[model samples]
Target chain A: MAKQQVISPLPGTFYRKSAPDQPSYKEEGDQVAVGETIGLVEVMKSFHEIKSDFAGTVTKFLIDNEDAVMAGQALVEIDG
Target chain B: MAINVISPGLATSVQDLGRPGYYHLGIPISGGMDRYALRAANMLAGNDEAAAVLEAVFMGPELAFTQDATVAVTGADLPPKLDGEARESWTSFAVKAGQVLSFDYLKGGARAYIAVSGGIDVPLALGSRSTYTLGALGGLDGRNLLAGDVLPLGAGTAAAEGRSVPAKLRRLPGAQAELRAMPGLYWHRITEASGRRFFEDTWKVALEADRIGYRFRDGRPLEFVERTPPFGAGSDPSNIVDSCYPYGSIQVPGGTEPIVLHRDAVSGGGYFMVGTVISADMDFIGQLQPHTPTKFVSVDMAAALAARHDRQAMLNEIRAMLA
Candidate 1:
């Protein structure tokens, strides 16, 4: 089985869940399908929904919630 | 036919719709300043809407068409002539081989677009032919046009004769333009007085305007209500957080003059974005010349979406007519 990773396309603050105090969309060891919403990235006041490009179980989150990410920075690792 | 550039205008470059899906790499989507005029020119020339065309600023080049082809000029109302004969804009005309084409000083607006039947045959960079002057990529070596440069036209057949611009395609009247904007990332940091001034007062385009950005002369310096630390781990006060800026984002450094980012603007900036001009109004903003009076109007997301849908409907009707 191959492992996959989701990456942030833009530099901004990342939110693990949709809003504050909400459960994260995915947790470590959780299954996700391609195009599934993984998280949201807030850049310059615009909130962009981050989607998983590959189907797999969550392995680990690269960055914590509210952490700033750079372009092409990895966000999540997933194992198939 | 080949045309020789005698004078390459103030800031001429080849542009198209723009390069998308690469903002993660910090590559700004550089394209035509007036996308509406560019697309209109292409449509009249019977070319794809995204085809590359010459974006001439202030003035245009003096050239001789080496072959017979059809061309259309749009956007700014620059006085254009062929072989010294005055010509009308927003209409296609036959350019005979050896006919010299020249444009006089712009009487109104800042930029004008010249479209040939087959479009400009410029090398593609990053899946687009738009010139990102800052990155020095795309368009005749990624710089402003210079004297003695000869641009090549793409290979394509021409449409029938007598295609003129539709009345609806003409730009709205009035030298005063009101730009609609959506609240940006740092919109809340500005004071209520500054926000009111931003929407109520008219700002004049300063002489410092260029492809990168347009500086406007706001009546008074803008002051932010809260001083949010710029993005970055550094303790330096000048450090700003790196962020992706969409087209039409207006950034104010030190809470002063408003600078509207244009096609050739940078991907990210270290300043506060008070607001972003709606996408549909970007073309109108591009045509603004120096000293032009303009105002910013705030609109909700729903209005912006509706405006976009309306534009799409119009475009679809035009396509249907051509089909």
Candidate 2:
């Protein structure tokens, strides 16, 4: 099995979708590539785009939208 | 190789370069407090500068290496030893398998960095391996090192050769390290006397200091200009607008004392940020022990840039020498 790499660039609440009512950018088993925008992290009223650093399939979403996360918390896992 | 911990010293945790770009989401950059020393140790071990390292505070753990490994210790000198013999710092050395490493009480400074060849093998979380203890994230199970923990080393097995300890570690000059003042959102709201005292006086680190924040013992109480209604739901007049705050911001609340936030500080805060310690001087701040007298010096934007450039040049020179 290939190693799955998880990347989270910022410290904030991980939001899976653009808005509360929308679906997530990815689901389990979704194919994702490096530099692909995976989700948004909202910090202090500013929204930042979290991008995938590895080309792989999304194996898991470790955090739910609106969940508070510290710096370096894994938000998603990518099977590289 | 593996290292077993006998006594997990005070507040020991795994750290790297820290997590950035998440302030807007209310996550502060949590990483090694003394970043320069950490980087130097990593470089000595021929590891990536951001590789995971053990951050030991005050006292350190008694570690037993399971295999031969190259290691470097940096930052605060806690009287570390290998197999009961004194160990040198800021230079890499070979540790025989099964040799015991331990640290005594800190004589100077607050924390130390232990970097193994390659790096510590903690799974990278949020692009870093630093532990944010308050949030319960990163490091080994998102907490301080405990007894019986075994940390794995990274894949590389290259041993360090010709260890050379420098006579003195470079530091930011105290005269040039007056804290810098940017006009924060609520900077103008304080009284003129309070503002003057903020620049003129030296503060003492209170016993309440920790990774979360360093509270200072200022002489006089700080009074707000006026109390206004809550800005938003759950917002109070004491709260300032949430914005990006760099490391070393000295935030003053309703109390007289100021709190100097460190690596594990929260992303955004509501208190008044009176001044920010320049990045060049931050490492020095990390070396401060409890009750240490800290004088906040003011640095203008131009001076801050010059200091940064000067430090970068020093780093480049060190790299060149190593090459």
Candidate 3:
């Protein structure tokens, strides 16, 4: 098995949930498919989905929920 | 030839200088946040200076060309990629029919303007090709570019490849930006101490920043002068009788977060504006990233005019060089 990381495409605040009241898109150990949204990066009031490219089990989250992220920053680790 | 949208990048929209003269009708002047960059890209692509270009924010749209064309990317260092190979920003390049154009990660700044030869051929609305998405008025159906959409191009001359703008002529923000502002109108509504602190304290660009306005945070709350609320105004100290909001006007809602209205801001609002960021500094605000430290430098009317003049001179220099 190999582990890969999902990277944020833009810089801004990262959110695990779509909204404050919603459940997180993914959690550790959750199975994810290619193109599955794992989180969102909000830039200048707009939220863009961070989709995983590898189908795998979520191994670890590299960035914390609601933390600031830079473009190309690794966000989550997945084991396939 | 047309551009086929492969993947519409985040907030990619058609924009020009903007649609003015209709703000009184509640129509905002929606266009590129950084006007200079838009014009520069258009000129480099051999289009009219005010021709519409695609404005991509943070990320660049994946586009496939239906014909060979010359193109230029300006503003922000979101390096343009022609079929996976990197191309220079602020320089004109050629893209062949069936070639895909994309962008690498944003290296600096915010929005990038992509100018293709002949410009975007979306029919003009309200005398401009700029998109006013809020009003659904101008641009291609008055919205952002979407996947699978085909954008037509106007007739244009072929601009020479490798036409590069000198590095010195390019505009990029420094470590910190000082936005010069002219305090007036409702400046007296806040306590003198609050007014002083507004100029003294450093503020961070808030996540709430967007096309409508830019919000700043981490600054001290403004203390307003005790006064009775005016008719139709809310009870909050930051509220005032509804008034016209000028572009670049700074309004502190609840006397806490200061929001500077930008190109697409509402025509009227109830908030009291403490001051307006001078025209010369408004472009700098557009390039500021979230969490960037900024200071509002207070300037008098004469200084503001002088800065405006200097900006015009700089534009003239660019025009002459390109001409």
Clashing pairs in 3: none
Find the candidate with the highest TM-score and give its number: 3
TM-score of 3: 0.95
Q: Which is the better candidate, 2 or 3, if ranked by lDDT?
A: 3
Error of 2 at B106 (Å): 1.3
Per-candidate TM-score against the hidden true structure: 0.75, 0.74, 0.95
Index of the highest-DockQ prediction: 3
The root-mean-square deviation over C-alpha atoms between each candidate and the true structure, in angstroms, is: 21.3, 16.9, 1.7
Local distance difference test, per candidate? 0.78, 0.73, 0.90
Model 1 CA deviation exceeding 4 Å by range:
A1-80, B227-240, B320-323
- Clashes by residue pair, model 2: A11-B22, A42-B25, A43-B24, A43-B25, A44-B24, B178-B297, B178-B298, B179-B297
**What is residue B246's positional error in candidate 1, in angstroms?**
1.9
What lDDT does candidate 2 reach at residue A14? 74
**Candidate with better DockQ, 2 vs 3:** 3
lDDT of 2 by residue, B205-247 (tens): 6656677677777557665666564554134434576555556
lDDT of 3 by residue, B74-183 (tens): 99889999999999999999989999999998888888999999999999898999988888878889888999999999998879998878988788776677899999
Q: Cα deviation of B198 in candidate 3 (Å)?
A: 1.3
Ranked by lDDT, top first = 3, 1, 2
Per-residue lDDT of model 1, residues B290-316, tens digit only: 566788888999998887787777666
lDDT score, residue B144, model 3?
Answer: 89
